[model samples]
Target: MSEMHELFLTCPKGLEGLLADEAGVLGLAEVRQSTSAIRGRASLETAYRLCLWSRLANRVLLVVSRFAMGNADELYQGVHAVDWADHLAPSGTLAVEFSGHGSGIDNTHFGALKVKDAIVDRLRSASGERPSIDKLNPDLRVHLRLDRGQAVLSLDLSGHSLHQRGYRLQQGAAPLKENLAAAILVRAGWPRIAAEGGALADPMCGVGTFLIEAAMMAADIAPNLARERWGFSAWLGHVPALWRKLHSEAQQRAEAGLTRPPLWIRGYEADPRLIQPARNNIERAGLSAWVKVYQGEVATFEPRPDQNQKGLVVCNPPYGQRLGDEASLLYLYQNLGERLRQGCLNWQAAVFTAAPDLGKRMGIRSHKQYAFWNGALACKLLLIDVVPTQFVTGERTERSHAHEHSDTGQGTAGEHPPAPAPAAPARLSEGGQMFYNRLQKNHRQLAKWARREQVECYRVYDADMPEYAVAVDLYRYWVHVQEYAAPRSIDPEKAQARLFDALAAIPQALGVDPRHVVVKRRERQGGTRQYERQGREGRFLEVSEGGVRLLVNLGDYLDTGLFLDHRPLRLRLQQEAAGKRFLNLFCYTGTATVHAAKGGARSSTSVDLSHTYLDWARRNLSLNGFSDKHRLEQGDGLAWLEENRETFDLIFVDPPTFSNSKRMEGVFDVQRDHVRLIDLAMARLAEGGVLYFSNNFRRFVLDASLLQRYQVEEISASTRPMDFARNDKIHRAWRITAR
Candidate 1:
């Protein structure tokens, strides 16, 4: 053993074997799988190679020292005892991470600090100069893991989080961690699947992590091809020539779109919440065409129109396996089973579920029970094969490969939920198409409310802009603005004329006045669909329809003043402000003030930190004939509210979820300083008066219990609009009255 180095690679819980396999591929000898990690012995070059190629590892570590670090003193002494000049110097940068211990030396930050002190002090005393810490992207990342009075220290060879594989330009909420994703693919026998060019399907593919990873493998693309940096590249004795060769080989494998053709991979989700994140990650992965996420449901999904090969349809669903209402989950799984059995016969199906009970409702005997863990919960993967007659398909071609070894178990085949399952009869109207009627039905229910809300929001639009642009002000809906290279066949002029006509015909469409319709336009830049990117690439502003409100800020973006998230807060103002004075601070375009005025407030004052918004507020008031009637002031909201000792019966306070307005005294964090803001706003509330405060932070917490100064009752229920029915608590809505 010519200079043996102790080392371990941290895997995300269940990816040990896969990570070990990757190391073995990279020429590491004596690679052994551990519980949530892997241990391997290799030369420094082997560690660097493994770092460059390992797809399922969080990070690869080169052990420096290990001891029973029970407290900070033990941690400091354990770290300081290492020879300082070996890998670190006063001029080099460093970073540290610690975990696994529940207390004592287990605190990640505390452990990290102590380790930092040890390294810096050791270097300072030896060389009279100390290396600095580079938290953003360190030259050296130190990891310390402790368990049951034992500690392990390793230098991270893999740079950044291995999850940033460089392929995703978009992501979904609670996205499958990259390590977890890799493990899922491996456990589903991706080696066998990849050899046969099988498809991966994610019915509830939040952000398309699994589909992207699988497609990357099928395309022979290097998962790290798009990544910018790696820890091995920053190693003291880093090999630039070897890294370049590895990178070039991976780059040569990258391809756009699906190489196998037809549909080898697909993902579907009903909630729009996952849409943007999914798009971002897909764009980042540069696999937009090979793997795409569609806004859809799984229950009635049909096979691809051009699928002629036997592919696998594997999915992770919201069977309360991780995040969802557990009670409503079993039925969803049953519906998924119905889709697989009735819609896909020539395909192999694998369902991964922590709730094996819910998996049983699929009513298909599992061929293999592969064990895994997502976070800490023990999970199982159930693979199945169905006979062609068991499927209800109107086929046009033959199966590419014969199913020789389905191995669907010989079991009782009737494990299900106790309560009667939902109507999952494997039948759908219109040739098994999804019930899109639900979306339309919800839109229908909110038609009246939408009309009213649009009217108030429109009060902020400039009415003097060009006809095409001004048409955007009258009504908010039925408007689409795109800045892109249009095909010759798609006439922009004709589209504009048609959209204008639609605006004029709004009354006929919805039995409401057409004058109430608002239409606006802005520019968009053409996107390289290879990245699934859809953004207005150039500068454009919300232009009024009739050249009345000539918004001159057309050099940057689309609809800057408006976001639909705060619709409920605006409604709350309109609901509770009758016969009361209202203060609309930070009033961008006086939309809230307009709603308050419309709700019959005695007086409404609109103030904003921006002179542009204040001017827009004046124009909006003039457009609605309230220019002189409404007090429009330009000032900092906090300062203005603080200086004036005035109280209102009704107050609407909705601030930017996060901002650092130099105009203000300090940076604002809604989560951390909500109480201070609320107290300040509530100071202006009169006795028995209602104060409506809301934020779209999604995770904002209001210490209402600590506010013995006021009686807080959630008014989010009262402000629920039809557009936000899917997720009512998308924002926290609360009403407080002086106790």
Candidate 2:
């Protein structure tokens, strides 16, 4: 027997056991599984076989040594102990991939640099030359992990992951990783189905990954046969004759397996440009004859006549990363479910998606679901049998279809036709009808103002009736409704019922689809909780306001990137900004600065405390083509004002009510800190300049002492727009000019 080595095989999360099973099936010894990796004892030939045959494994690593280390000095000593000559020559190029967190070694780059220094010092002493580092394609790749005080160093045997089967050269918008696709197939029980000669189909196959992978599995082809190079190809310890013999054995197996009857595999893609790439990848994988791809939509997809009776229908349809995407996907998913339930009667199906709620709209029940991660996104693979009984009834389908098609024709210039309203139940209370009537009255009054002023997003209703307590705002075709947290004395059940009534009344009275309405609770935020994400739907919509386009995220954050109450103030700044140097303090998303830029400001400066908001501000500026003469800095707003010597003719300061975020040195209270915040801002004001200060604290009171230093006028009444006429306390604005 040859020498035994400790080997570790890493895979995607949730596939650890499957990888271990693959290792055991390949005749390895002592297979064990962990959270995201598998361990076993194997000879050199066994490692080679696992790398070639195992489709789920990410990388095959050979463990060199493990020790206890805490800092950079200890890490250097530990890596220095490994023999340099045994792995590579002194002239060979190498790269170190370092990971893990430890005391005093918190950064990966510093740790990697230390590891590189130790290797070069050892090799330079032995052969009078040191290897150079190559990050892209290195001859030898070393991996080091540090946890607590323990370090495990290993060699990355697989160069660029075994999943890069060399077939997919071009990918679609959001392509699935190859290993993740393989894991999905394994969970779908593809191996067992192939053994029984069942066929396979992918209705929304992007670049033909699932279909090509399925064909290779049925033909018993090695997953990594088409790879151009491997880590061992450059190592000094590589055995050429042994690797050649194993390679020939795999070729013979693939050749004989191809002679047998192949399972019928088909792929359908909606994008025409993707069909050629899918076919090109299929040809590259040497599965051209067995796997076929065609350009077609999922609604009309059908199994071929020569295909087997019952197989697996697997697809990773578009799950919509943004708010707008989710509204459009309900119809696509419903169509897919209809096609499968009616056309492919006896087949089993697997739907992988990040939005399982959208998956539920498919009108089918999933008997089994497995959780998996596609990179950073946690996804699910749902298994269902395509039977008539699994689908929803006719009435439910009709309602779902109506919601899906309401957003059509909404992209035009003129008024869009309203979708037919659902019949109101007889049990609806008088308060609900009154709520509907108020929305209708509000829409009628605001329609003329919205069109004449060119404002698409405005407050329509603000708690008009005491019984219905919610605020509704219109952002073009979509509506956002925020319900205030009901008082504790109110019954939870009654409050919920009132809330449901308000949600139902919004769409019918406004002539908008229910799908266009989003509901959220308005609560007093603590610390930075208001800025935190409410959901992971990455949808952003473009809306017009004051003649400039701004991106509004209706799904992700509590605030839709724009404060509806400050609409008039932003327009005022735009009207007064020509030929002035402008400065925006606490610019949440740079909306004010964009307004100034569009109004022909000479130059503008924006400062904020959050990097996330700062990046958003940059995007907002660039979106309007405000390219030059605009600078955005991210830091403490007060500190920035104290350090800045530049003066501006116009400045806008809109601050949060209370903030105790970690990025700030001290807590901010609009009532307590307003004096100091304004004094510092005034020091940088240019001659004859005016500053507009605004806040959303409803009960705020301005200090009388500020009137003595500057001419202060409360313009809150004039600044409030007509949409907010019902609720005059939405925000307070002040105009202060140097006396």
Candidate 3:
């Protein structure tokens, strides 16, 4: 009978169950599970087979001896009890790893030293020569664990973690370890899907970890087949014949698996830099024929597999770790969900993410959720079936029969008409109904005023109810909902629930498609955070205000290019400026400058620090057929005002409340720098010319000293349009002129 050796297979946390099942299948006896490890008994052949076959295990250790120990002396004695002659020659090199901290061995290094000393002493006394220590690539590697005063010593049968696989020498930032990637694929049921001749794809494949792992699993290729050296290779008791037999079998199986029809496996990565590296990894894995990678973004990702093939879509999208990262990632997840719905019908999907709340915004229902740990961060694996039933659709409106007819202008002739669009629940919750009623009331009141005033964009709701703390704005056909960050006193779950309710009611109340509604979380921004980009969609929509066209990017920026609350001020600039020199400071997107140019300003200069916004200002001016005369200067506003040698008849100064932009020499606080800012603009003010200064700091106090130097009149109320009537502190404006 073959000897049965006790074995321990260590895998990543949360994969013990799967590893245990695998061990039992590989002919291990009495399989047992523990945290990050599986314990079982196997013959030497089975042990070798496991080392080659395990897709999820990190290392496989073969138990050599177990004994009771009370202190370091006992530890030495127990290790010395093992017959060294059977495992290692006296001149052979060895290494030791110690774990746990009991039996008077408080430090791992001390515990390892004791074990090493005992082995060397026993060997040296018998053979007159001692084994040398080689930490890397040792002939014999030993591991000792002190558990509740009992020492269990084992030989490391799998050298260097099995997850290395020898294929991925290069990877991207935050790459998933191979074993964890395998576990994700296993939980995602990639094996079953692959066996059915289905395809696989990864949208955000960083270095193609998932694609290569999935390909190896489908092709019946042993993960460690290409490994040249192992922990037991140089051991005295190593059985080369048994390992060779298993290796031969794996090779034959791989050959056979490859001879069959190839499964379509592909990866798409957004970063062009990772494309060649991912392809290199695929080639190293010997799966270039089956797996391919391309440089593509999630927004345009489409898996073009063989006809009639349906399989899995899996990816580990970045769950941001920095502030304001989640806000931008919302659109990424939304885009991914949109792609899955529009392109990959009747398929399966698994999204492994650390941010489960962002996953909720994907607009799809995950049928099952499994919790796992990627390093120390707790993550969730969302398993979804991309069938029609899993899609989250908005409330359906009644359509006329003529609209439902085919584009050929004929009723169904022979082919079946496409399925009617899915509809959400018609009845809303009580809270949602109340919110919808309030939105309808606000829209009715604001819609008439907006149409009468020729306003295409305006605010409709501004935290009307304490429970639903979100502002909803209408941009023609699109809806922009900004959810105010709830205070710490409110339960986050409750706040999220209220937000979901409000979102469900927004499209219905505003008479817009749900897809046109963009949602963002509004928190108090510090420094230049508000100006920083939140997304990369780069989609700019052209809208008109006061007979002038302006471009607004609703997805890429936190604040759309045009400020809805500042409409009145922009209109006033247009109404008051005629053949006058206009100067606009802190001209974000230069909406005010556009208005001034449209109102027949002789010449205008827009000053800002950001070149990106200055370009945007240039575009805004060009859109209105006034470009050469409108000089767009990119510099610090205060510095530009100081260096100017000219004066203007109309000047609009709307500075941020706080800015610590990197372009500036120092921080600029509106409250602290307003005096200098006003003094500089007042100097640039031509005689008898008007200067309109405004800011949005709620508690801002006008400098009392400026009251005595100039003729100043507060026009905050008059400048605030009707849309912002409810929020009296939205902004403060003053009309100033030379005394």
Which candidate has the top score in TM-score? 3
In terms of lDDT, which candidate is strongest? Answer: 3
User: How close to the true structure is residue 565 of candidate 1, measured as C-alpha lDDT?
Assistant: 48
Over 17-73, each residue of candidate 2 has an lDDT whose tens digit, in order, gives 878888898867898887788888999999889888889989999888898986788
Q: Could you tell me which residue pairs clash in candidate 3?
A: none
Clashes of 2: 4
Instruction: Rate residue 556 of model 2 by lDDT.
Output: 80
What is the C-alpha lDDT profile of model 3 across 577-617, one tens digit per residue?
88999999999999999999889999999999889899998
lDDT (0-100) at residue 705 of candidate 1? 62
Error of 3 at 78 (Å): 7.2
Worst ten in a row by lDDT for model 1: 408-417
Candidates ranked, most accurate by lDDT first: 3, 2, 1
* lDDT score for candidate 3 against the true structure: 0.86
Which ranges in model 2 have alpha carbons more than 4 Å from their true place? Answer: 125-127, 304-308, 392-739
For candidate 3, the TM-score is 0.72
lDDT of 2: 0.82
Off by over 4 Å in 3: 64-153, 166-177, 184-220, 257-368, 382-461, 464-468, 472-481, 498-520, 525-562, 574-649, 658-684, 700-710, 722-726
